[model samples]
Target: MEAFPRAILIDLDDTLVDDSSNVDACWDDACAAVAPRLRGVGVDRLRAAIDRRASWYWSDPKRHRTGRLDLRAVRRHILELAFAELGIDDSGLARDLAEMYRQLREERAQMFPGVIDTLDRLRAQGVRLGMMTNGAADAQRAKIERFGLAAYFDHIIIEGEFGAGKPDRRVFEALLSAFDVAPGDAWAIGDHLEFDVLAPMRLGLHGIWVDVRNAGLDGRPGRPHRVVSAFTEIVETPV
Candidate 1:
């Protein structure tokens, strides 16, 4: 743990980038689009309903679409389900709202504090850097291009392009293999405990989970190596 890792892997959303900012805006757009259908419900109430339904759908660990590799389909499905819950079972309406949300969200995506500097420093130190994120091709690529993030990474592996996702040892293994680095000589960091940290830990990589939400780590195994509340901690000593 004293030596720096030879290769480094990082997550996209909430780790190196603050994707929620645009996601919130996208939800605002969705609310505006659905306001007319809310008969008696307030905009705030319908927004909550849609968010809850979408969250419920994506929170299913075993659901294939939860990986969000196909953002268009998954998001459309989420809105469709939400509409059904609100007695507005119109697929066309759901599709339009989903497309609107995605377009706005991608246009407004922003990186987290110090992401560029941190990645630059790591790359300067000869650390092999890779971005292993689960997202749709266009949506995820838009973020990389919008923020010029591709300059910092030696590998940009999106699950949509790679055909695999985290928690699957194959995805973790394939990354290290591509870099020709052993798991023990690499580190993987992300916002999600299981997908980013726990899975990598099992693969012999030093997995660090950035719990930006202040989620307590109690009762979980300490194999994640480290858990911090900020993204800047990635550059700290012994990372």
Candidate 2:
């Protein structure tokens, strides 16, 4: 165990907030809103069909690199599947649905349990906080605002805004620069192994993998510098 780093970088989705729930709700809303246009398409059935296509797009080896899926593209692919299922011949509808989902998603931002308390403790301990996420600026910003999380972060970097996504050192570099700290002086906490852990590890920073589900990595050779299942565990463990 070592002393906590001077600064902390956190991922948004599934790290601080339970975005999966928001995403599910957005899908449901989209299905209901589009139902009339879909005519005989049942909402539940449509949701299930869209989820299946989105899951495939996320898990497909050809689509994801190092198992890191781009959420924006996943949204588009899901909409495309929905349109195809309903025999809708318009490509523009896919874009429209994606945009609609983004709007709904921005409106629903729920913080995970213990996020605020942990963040408050960390800030009081004199640690700088920053956010690194892979999503569009508008949706991400809206979530931060709705959840009242924007004031705590010294820096907030969205990958889509920078024209790049995670698993890339450039994104991490941007955060480091914003914090005016070197990689060695900071730690990155994220739930995803590929994007959050391995990506920051490449830049010589400490990578703390938040494996809340306790799902073991499959044949992964090396482990993260630190692993925690809960947000409070961060303060107990050496950063």
Candidate 3:
């Protein structure tokens, strides 16, 4: 995408939304909540189990399409699995702890600094806008609605609803088709190098990495067309 691109697809979560503090807090709370019930189980051990389960869950893209893609469900599964492994049988406690984390996560989402202005400016320029998120439909929709994002995005695609996640060309194609824009006339901005940038790049859409915290891009063959530290930087130049 170049010279006033026609469309921009954005990733939710850590990209456009700031949820970092909540992530840590959620884990801390979950560990604490589950520890007392499980007796000898340490918070560190439960956290490690969550991290391990999260890695496994996200790596397999197919798992995202299933209705089981509810993030709370994933955490609940992690808690349940960990409890079972430790020979503790209290499904109620595990479910409650996981639900607690999910609520904290939903309550903490906010736009990254300058993200709203950037999006507004892009929309004012007549650039078609859309959201592509890898989450359950209801979970992702809550964040979108909580932030009043419905007016900004012309289309929204949640992997759980759409049956495909990022790094998949189909997601890009669907957005392109919806906007009636050619690939060269559109761009994608995301915090994720591989999923947000590389995936769109593969389909001929300009991919810009929005690494607000200066996170280094990982080694990947599908290079981003542009790299930016903040949304303000992207809008300053208008793509």
For all candidates, the clash counts are 0, 0, 0
Alpha-carbon runs more than 4 Å astray in model 2: 25-38, 42-44, 60-77, 86-104
lDDT of 3: 0.79
Model 2 root-mean-square deviation: 3.9
Give per-residue CA lDDT, model 3, range 1-239, as digits (tens): 23578898988877878866477777787678667776777788777777777677667857655534666667777778767766668888888888878777776667878778878888888989989988678878878888888889999998889998887889999999999999998989888788898878888888899776686666556568788876557776544
Q: What is the lDDT of residue 202 in candidate 3?
A: 80
TM-score of each: 0.87, 0.77, 0.87
Per-residue lDDT of candidate 2, residues 89-205 (tens digit): 667767777878877876665678888998998898889998988766776776788889988899888765777778778888888888788899999999888788888988989
Residue 174 lDDT in model 2?
Answer: 85
